[model samples]
Target: MESLLECIICKEPYNQSNRAPIILTCGHTFCKSCVHKMSQHSQYIRCPIDRKFESRDLSSLNMNYAIVQIQEYERTGILAKERCKAHEFPIVITCKTCNIDCCPKCIRKHLSHDMYDMEHPTLIQELDNSMNGFEIKIKEYLDASFSAKNRLDKEISELDHQKVKLKKEIEDAFESLMRILENKKIQSIQQLDHKIKEKEDFLKQRLNDVNEQIKYYSMHYDEFQHMKKYYKESTFIDRVVSCRNVLRELNFVQFIKPKDINDNKLRIIVDTTPLIAHSIGSVSFNEKSSSEILMEQLNFQIEELKSNKLIYNKTNPEQKLSLEIQSISNFLCMSENIPELAKMHLIECCCNEILGYSSLKLSDHLKQELSKKIDTESLFDTKIQEYIPTLRSKLKYVKGLIYSLEKIHEKEWEKGLYVLHCLIINENEYDFAELYLQIALLRICSQSFYIINQFKVIDALPLVDLIKRYTKFHFLPSTMCYKQVMSSLRFAYKFVENQMPDFFFPYFKTQYSAYLTEMSSKATENIPSEYPSELLAIFQGLDSSDLHFWKDSDLSKQFLNKVHRFKEECSPWFQALRFVQERGEELSDFELAALERSLN
Candidate 1:
């Protein structure tokens, strides 16, 4: 009877002394004492059913009235002592054979049956142990359910994230391809219109010339008739004799409109295979159909282009601007795993739309707004530190957009670069002293170079100042930083040497070149010979064969130390070095020279 009203977690009966039953956040009921014990173990009580974080304090839990009612019903049985229903006597022993509770009087009727002594202390102890074991099994099942829920929820969240990212990538790629097609379409239509307008103007001029000649002949014929009717025969003959020279000189060349030459007319022959292949191509509209139906639809569209009553469901520029703003803002909310290809493609699409707004002074407005948001004084204020990370991420996004615009758009290139220069200078004010921030600045400078070279134009003074600020103040010559510095310098050299030769000396190109050479020699000293060609290109301008340049540099001792250290390491190259050192006596002079050079 006591087993029927116990807490599953503690296997203690629900009673006034044990504090009855209390419901947990997991919807399982336990005694108040057990809940307090759980709270003492951890700051939070994990729900056994789902592992959800729950309050540890027992005061917030509700009392289980259902368990109270069940306890009351069990307690009120047969006047405080359960008795046999059939015999109307106090129950003493339970018959094992008949599976019934019985009294001493009832046992006379069941003398042949086996029985259990209900008063046996060992049997009561065994029952208590069984109840305790059942409680443990119930807790185990709850824990297993909680773990499964956790794993499933995580998988569900990750899958949803991936689905969103994949959809976005598909949209971005198609948006770029659509822009390319629209530009091509506009170009083709403009060329066709120009050619047709030329022909139409020529025809109009010819028709006006023909009309003037007809009027000239009509006036002369009318004058000739009037002379015959109003003057003497001699006068008429004299006039005719005088006009004969004019009439003989009169020559009319008929102007016939030229036949439509099919070659001159635009005959759009679209290749349908590329569309089926789902790839980029010159053709836009294509169909796999019978020739008759294709021509009918084509002719209909050609006529439709001339119609003035057409309704255009075009998006307004303001609406497009808003949509683009939202799209770019989505980048900030994205937490992880954005592919570089997708980033470039999406930015290019946005830049294509932004090109139409060059007259609006959008870049200047954006720069002012961003700088205001990231004011130097506010960043140092005590209250704004928590919001610093969000502001930094948004600023980084803006810098990325500007870099992309400089690469892809022409008219906006100068404006974007100017804005980016301001942003880099602004960033320096806040994070100049930090090493990681300086590393980021180096990468920004590196990215800026490709765009500058691509457009073949720059505000050379600002660019030079920006580069000097990063490299001079924050010079950390690690492998990655070295590559970035050398690349930018190479682009800077090309930009000066080819495009702006006159701007070279005043902008410190010579000094920068020397700095790049030093960095290259240091950066490439420890690099293996099998490193990528891109890495090798950074050292291209710095002569690898210049023994004096390498030997005289400050990094030469460090390089020598590294070479010796490499020889001692356990690697394939080190094994080869070890073999050569072991067999030094057998090597010829040329072979020995080659081995020595390999270490250098």
Candidate 2:
């Protein structure tokens, strides 16, 4: 009994602190500190009793409150003896029929009940066997839950990583397109400016020539008048004769007019049809990628489990146990069921023991049968055969819609719109269809905003329609949170509605209210200026060549010390610098230069 309350690893009794008993998924209890130490050596904990690997976080392990209670009872001598309420006689016997402890005087009341000595070896062995069986079932359930959770967690993480990758791809595609458009715009403007300058120069030269002619003609007229008024008749006659030849020349000259100036207009006719058709790059999904394949498999498994039901009802005890097991298995698949499920398992075990029936063995058998039902491909196929084709078809159609949307072609835009409308309207009929639709719509809105802001080739009508549909469908407060969804929505709103929605700014402000408050408080507070020991170590280890030339001087140490003491107070900046310093030779010169420039 004493050994039962002690940790196998440390051979110490359980306590509330460091020696607190924690049960692993394998149903083995050990001290918290011992488990923590074991977990440090590996990603998984290998149960010392069964040598089974349980991939559970040490901190998440359930504390064995039962053991704690028992230990406390033992410490207080509460389990040492029990007295009958009426006779005040010591209770040393258990009424097996009633499943209760009783004194000798109480035996008269339970005369027809089957009684056993408290210290009877056979009774003790029976109790231990029953407990062992219960433990086995509990372990099986826990293992299944842990396995399902781990797989789900891994898949979620992979999808998240894929989401980030896809976002970057979209950004890169748009950035490249924007660059091309920018270059074309600059070139067009330059050409237009050059043509205008050429036209202006020609007009200026022609005007100057005409003005010279006018000045000459005016001076000739004035001279003729002066001769007529003041010169001798002979001189005036000679001037007239000289002017006669010039007048004949002027009559044949034909002065420049507006019509003769070649009034051709320069216009830029941009044929955006071809650019719109081909310039925007397409987004695509590899349907057969490992992640996609895994996702499909997981979806199939989840669907199969959800559809599964026990063939029998609770009238039969064995079937009741089976149903309980099935129900627990279903609950265990969910992330939030661990605490509740643990308590339920404990209660079920206690109930089974008190009932004096070996439901544990029955539960174990049912568990195996359930496993086979779930695991056997032929059985699963037979079970879900009716809806398989329909499910596949729906998935394929959704994939096609996603592919068309990703192509970013003007022709496909309507098709994308149609897909979104259908998805939103029939969202209830499909599993994960709403999620896919939401993300796709958000991406479209984001892309539309990019196109309008950068090139204005694509129409904003579709973007506006999409945003309206998104809002009408109440797609805000999406599974993808505000931070992710709002950025795209805000940009789309600005382009379409010309103003941000009331929800946008407030959502962000409220979401980051705490962070903003912290920042505001920090802005007014004095921060520590000295570098932490870890940072100081990193600074000292940095290569001398990477440092400035002044580092070679005798004042280098003093300079470094002074800089460390008072140069800056931003912890994040210091951490980033320390990270860079720690990387040392791993970072390239260009990367280092970029980091330095960023820091500056």
Candidate 3:
């Protein structure tokens, strides 16, 4: 009975004040304060008990007088009933027409109006029906609230985990930088100590020589004084010649003075400008919204596909490749403001797709896709056009390379060679540093054909010239292009060895020898300790009986070992070449085709 008088939401007993029971049109009652909170100061109110919406204003809603009377009875021993103002009697009947409660004496005021007794059985039955399943509704509401709270808690926990992970990454990054700085510091100090020791040793040796000279001069002076005091004039005259000879010899002696030591002091000059500019590192809030982060993640997946890590399989290989190209095209259309690295990766992927396909028509498909999707003007900045051209021009160069490979595949060697030569001649128009390696490889491939077919001893000169040029200007033998270049050169050497005895001997003895010397000097410190065996084999061939430039067994072996260890790592193409070479067989036709398409 006490529970029936309380509001289910606030669990407080209804009273005449803010907690006065207000009834909704749905026949559910709640305290006035809870109703106000539910209404949120609006005209409409939704019953929390039944979830039924009411359009009537909060002030217009009827009060639950039955619960109010019960609450009043609980507070006082006697039931609190309203008395008529006109006749002092408890109100019993309610007038329907006037919508008011009236006593038996005051019933004349609303006589003609319809009226009903306050204790009608029908009214009590309607009230009982209103509260059916009330507990079940309350439980549902509680369950929904708990679910929302659990979702919020999960989000907060994930955020905390991310914070900890980011903190550790920051610490690891700084720790790596600190380790590098410490190593640099130690190296610098060791170099300083070595320079100081060399200078100190030279100064000490000079001091010892100067001291000996001073002692000899003092003894000669003492001997001259003794002869003058104790010997006759005749003995002194004979000794004078010897003394003059000694004086002449002493005058001729070259003495290194303390002041003569030039200032060859070593001092370390550390440049902190780059460090000041970049600082240690930085952490800031990610400015991208949720939608933008999703876009970047999608773009990253496309990049993986472009690198050929994710395979796209279909019955027709050409169609499969075309679909992959179209995927990139679609991605480019949606995201106009892609990063520069992303754009480069896209171009590289497209090239790879075209190269992998057997059909010549896919190249045309790539061109069409690129033309439709890429925005030329927006991609290439006018200010930096010299360093990097527009994407269109880059694609054009790629198309030319593809065309040359096709011609080579068709056995149209002259046409293929012509196209490659034209590209190489106009290489400066493109990004030279980026494309130089490709052009160099193609030139070496062209020269390899001449060595095989023409059988001209002079054909090997261009190969030697090409190597000398690479060694002098662009010396990065650890790279895949460098490895391929050396491999091709070695093949050329083997082909003409029986015929041309000293074809490459002169260049290897002079220029090549000097290059090896330079590499050997820097091998211990700057250069890596592992290299491809193919690269090391080239130098081994140079140490033939005729051209024994590498004949110093002990020194040459150690130098070759260091160069071998310089870079044990190899790119995919280098590994393929090694696989073929190990079996004592030439590259397969497919391998050659792939080699011609190599961009890196």
Candidate 4:
């Protein structure tokens, strides 16, 4: 019974007569038919004892002769019995994947070390344990990853909590500062009130004197008439002229006056340094705001606020202010419409900061994925010590940026916004785009919006894009300018409108048809005419029925004429194009029914 061969799959003994050609290894054996099938699958003999990923060598497995030798005396089982080659024991044979031996006591021990255990243990666990150290390493990596993820979650929670708290504190600061703004303006408010009060006091005094004289005159008129002749000598009884000058002066009745944000700036636009005259509006007052006054007030307020304070650097005041600007959204626009502008500025800056942070974090993923594609030398750039003239010159460029942003606050809407627009129009460089967007966000979109008209060139379509980006602002491009830009760009203005609806929506908002008509009527006579033909054709065709088309359809020319209202053909296709687009619906059930009815 112990001299029997074991099956690779079943791991049990079978009779010699039933034995098949097999390979043996580690005292385990499997049938040749099974081994041959397994060999075809793998380049190296994968241990059936432990079905780990391994190659199978077909040349090494000999099956037919071994099976034939065992079965030669299968009719006489005693003759077929063999001795163990390594030790003096009755022999059993088997394939390499599973072992069978005559020595039962040693078999149990050999089975204990087997990659796939037969009894008292699990085969899967032995196979797993058989892996070279990578399993432990991979397990450790996964564990560490989970721990890190947990830590990251906690960190994110803490950061979100901090963000909320910071936001609250920032709001509290804004609210408090707004109160200060109102409080400070009380002085100006009082000054106007004082002027009105002074005028009233002067008028009242004269009225009181007039009443006194009138009362005296009523009682002493006859006596005074009697003395009029004697008083011709102009002695102690000299008649005093009634103070009618008071009545005349009192005629200057003061009217109530309402001031805008510009009016409040002197008192409310607090700063750490005295604001330069340039910081104020285009229109000047009798008195310019003192730079010292602003500096002292802003410093005190900054110090008054919890640890965060607005301060001026001894060397670079602009850099310091720019940095602090990230702290507050409230900006002092040189215009009267400051509160509205300030609200917009604050929201934009906060959003921008969040965007920058998010993108910076995501940038790492891009670097990892694309690092293989990137150049090792260029990216690593080990030639730092050998800074040639070209590199040295480029290195000097950051100073120029510092210079640019330093005096940025000094610029007003017209000059500043134009400069910003000109700087941002590049489609080539990302760094340029970043700088442009940053500067644009910092500077409100009031003035550059107008200056876009100055560049009526067909190629500078980016101006239209910029206008689209800042849609909330009032920007009215001429119909000609729009035509030129869209025509030159090979895309319709509606393409931009559709892609960037949020930006253009405010300009084309509802309930403004009257205003639009009024503005159109009032527009200058020489409405420039760079007619884009394709746009006209589309609008004309869309106005027609049956949104389908054919090869010869001059829909392009049709769109041009129809859109610009230049001309339209009397074709049925043109008429149909107008019909479907006006409905702005696809071929629906009702439309289908209408089409069939029309055909019938």
Candidate 5:
């Protein structure tokens, strides 16, 4: 039996000494030495059994370990069957109860038990039939194993080939990109040269024109000197008249030199430092997304598999799917090392485990399966319902985030703002964060304004306290907080004006005064020193109605002072001063007097 497992070419029993047994691509087993000898002629060696070509060489072939184990087991079974342990005589009878064969002399001890006679002709024939059936089953298992392995080997080879092709494609793409950039660089240089040449020509023409004018003037002066020194009175007078007529005939050409076009330095559209950094970062990000890049490669691989008819499903007999046991193994074997692929495999595994099934199901069957997994006790159970209570827990998650940030700020506000800024920026990088912020803001807006309207809810903090919490957390360098928390403040303020007049009015009045102070300081700096006609154009466009809100505070006195200072320094401020002066109804008597004094 062991000799049957020997290599056909080497005629040697499979063992480690002969490099055991290994199967070629053609499903032929051979000792490693024989395969090596065949591979010496070419990498594509023919199988000893089928004369078919094997793409991989001897070293890369998979070991036939099952055959080797079978050979060892057969050799052990032969030795075990050589003699009986119960009786030393030539064993003939078999005791089925003890599972022992014995001589006829020892068989009398087992007469009362269930047993099989080893020497019975019918029993031996039946055993031979059973052995034949076992051989057929073994052959079927072997065929299936070899077929699965062949598909796996082909897939691995294709994956490697795709990797090489994709690498070349990336290299070509970068080379093409470099070529385009080089062309653009040449064009930019040529454009600069053209501009410089144009400027040079203009300067040279002005220089020649100026020199011609100087030469004409010099000749006329020389002629005058000669008349004064040597010419008679009548000749000098006639010459003077002729020269004056000539001078009148000469056209006056004003040569105004062009201002310097630009200093001797390079000017580019945008500083490339940030652009280059962004480009490098984008490349690194693309490299990290290799799985997405390989999606196109996977499509090509699928096409190749279709050509080979290696469809993974089992609706057709050509497909050999052992999904019940090898689904996970098969999935991972083909899938790239990507988290999304792993997640899909996990979802499939969980479904199979929970439902005791695989693949598609009818709607009714799916419902039945889902019913088994769901809790059906109560309609209001949290597992099956939505529960929203009063405002403390309404934005619990957002409130927690604010509280955490406050704790960090207690350590140091600067560091807290830095951490908060980092978090916000990181959140912006993902698509989901915007939705998260929007949902949180919606809940907050609804709850805060709802409480402000009710006023006597008696369950939560005031809108002012919530607004303060939001502002305390809003001290970020980024404008994101202005759009988020400041918008919330606007909503609160809108509600506060009508709902809680005393607290809201006082708070708003103070805030408005501070805002005016800051505006005055900024407007002072931005106002030009020696006001150009451009200031008159700017002042003409200012609408007095826009400043009507300033009447709500006493700070209008200081704001009027700022306008008066501008009016005294520059005449262009006259229109703006008059516009403010005419809004006499909105201004206090002191502010009106100040405006009038400025106009004077």
Candidate 6:
């Protein structure tokens, strides 16, 4: 089975010293010199002879491991142990490398050997004695741990059973006691009623006896007065009758609704107001896909910057005024003219062909204007006001378009997805802030409003509110959603890196690292037994955890550069998140207008 051939170069019988060669694309042998020469060009090394590529660090190639096995049979002259690669003696060591096989004799020779026993003549004897002691201790600890765990488990099971039994018993006893108490109260009420009636009757009899005597006296007095004939117009008997009036009374009780004797009809009601931030704009879209839009908005100042640049001679050599960059800076708008400009621009783009017919038909004049130029103004339909009514309709159609695009992306774009990674730049100031806030509101509400079946392509990212929320929470978002968000981020990250790096600082760094780690762990944990190149790629650069650099208040600028590098390193590590990185909120004209409608 061993080599029955000769070496190509030497033309000699193959011996253990010489080995079979692996071919490379360069028509060279797979010898160390051949591979080493190719290493200087790239991190990946492809066999020039075979044109095979290993997309990993070439330095990490295990040449010893990958090389053909020993060319000859073992030299069987002596029963001596195999020699160590380094010491060239009978092996007697467990190598310092994470784990390696070694024999007893060579183990004591190497000073770096992790398990070497230099002090002892018979190291194996000493190791066996130490191992026996270690084994005894381990057994003792394990035995104690097992006993405790078993007792706790058994007790927990018993307690659970007892809890169930006691709960049932208590409920049954409580019901029976309630019935008994109710019966006793009813009987007591009956007895009290009988006693009250008897008392009332006895009292009535005594009152009647006294009343009869009084009646007789009154009659005798009247008769005597008549016989005497001394009565005037105001007689004595008439006066006495007028002075005292007879009294009649009956007891009444209040009525109540049926619930229980212990229950009351009173109810409690509370109205509380939430401390909600006033939104710049809101969306009728679902939250699932609006995350991308949210990220873009987050990266900028939202509304366009209107800084009036005023430069002057510093030394007053020429008192000259420079420039005035102006727009109404107030948060409460000065007028509707500015928004009109935005709307006009948006309409001009006409990016949303899925216009709502009803909204367009709101006014005959506007409908005629929009219909005249659908082809020319698709991407630039900036006026968001006129389209509010039909926003839902247009949104419905556009979303359908998105779904269609996803279903047949090849037919539609030829490219997997074509996205504007840098859309809607320069977000600053109250107006821009308002625009962005609206963008956020639009993003947050977009996916929440739409259902899975209602829209063609479901975008669950770039909703401004959701993006803000997600950034604050640091989450592993949906794959499609993340793709869209990454597009938004790519645009915004440019501005942040160039202009607003000071604002986000290390927060982006921290979150970026955390996101990569979480994504990688998920990839590794869910990796299949078979090859998972896609997942493996995601897991790369995730071994290192996020390194914090900023304190609560005092942070230097040095941390910023580090943070930038960290994010850059982690950016390509997760392909799942990257695949959908650029797909974002594709809002219809009416949908954009719908946001303005809620503003009022």
Q: Each candidate's lDDT (Cα)?
A: 0.47, 0.51, 0.52, 0.38, 0.45, 0.37
Top lDDT hit: 3
Cα lDDT of model 5 by residue, 467-563, tens digit: 2333333322223422333444344445455756574556554663343343223122211122224323443444422222211223323333333
TM-score of 2: 0.28
- RMSD to native for every prediction? 27.6, 41.2, 25.8, 32.6, 29.8, 36.0
By TM-score, the candidates rank as: 3, 1, 2, 5, 6, 4
**TM-score of candidate 3 against the unseen true structure:** 0.31
List candidate 2 stretches off by more than 4 Å.
Answer: 1-90, 114-129, 148-178, 201-205, 208-600
Model with the higher TM-score, candidate 5 or 6? 5
Global local distance difference test of model 3: 0.52
Give the least accurate 10-residue stretch of model 3, judged by summed lDDT. 543-552
Provide the lDDT at 42 for model 3: 57
* Cα-based lDDT at residue 548, candidate 6: 12
Better of 1 and 3 by lDDT: 3
Tens digits of per-residue lDDT for model 6, 1-600: 223243333444432232334344344444444455567787678765357775555344432321233432234533444555543344555554435646555454444646643334466676688899999999999999997887578658766986798778777877787698689668867876776777677667756766776776576556556544533445567644433221111112122222232353233332222312422243233333222332233223123322211222121211110010011111111222243333333332222211212233234454444434333233233444443323222222222222322322232211101110001111111322222222232233333233211322123222332344432222233444444443433333332344434545455545543543443343322211221243234324232111111011122222223333423432332222333344344323353334323422
| Candidate 3 vs 6: which has more TM-score | 3
Model 3 lDDT per residue over 172-260, tens place:
98898889989977987898788778878877887787788788666766865765564455646566666566667667755544455
TM-score, prediction 6? 0.26
**Model 1 lDDT per residue over 549-588, tens place:** 2112233333333323322421323343334446543234
Task: Please say which candidate is ahead in TM-score: 4 or 5.
Answer: 5
Give the per-residue lDDT digits (tens) of candidate 4, residues 1-600.
234445646554543333354554434466655666676776756766765543335545434344434554564564444445444244543323454543443454455343332332454455467764678888999999997887678668767987798778777877886687688678657876776677677657766766776665564555545445454555634333322333344355343232232532223233435524424333222432222333343344334322323332232432333322332211122212232222232222222333322112324443333233222222222221232222222212222232233334443323333332323331121242233333332122212222322332232234333433332223333243222222322222222335444654454333123323333343432222222243224333441112112111253233223322311211222233345446543333444333323322
Off by over 4 Å in 5: 1-81, 103-111, 121-126, 156-168, 203-600
Tell me how far the alpha carbon of residue 340 in candidate 2 is from the true structure, in angstroms, after superposition: 44
Could you say which candidate leads in TM-score?
3
- Name the lDDT value of residue 387 in candidate 1: 30
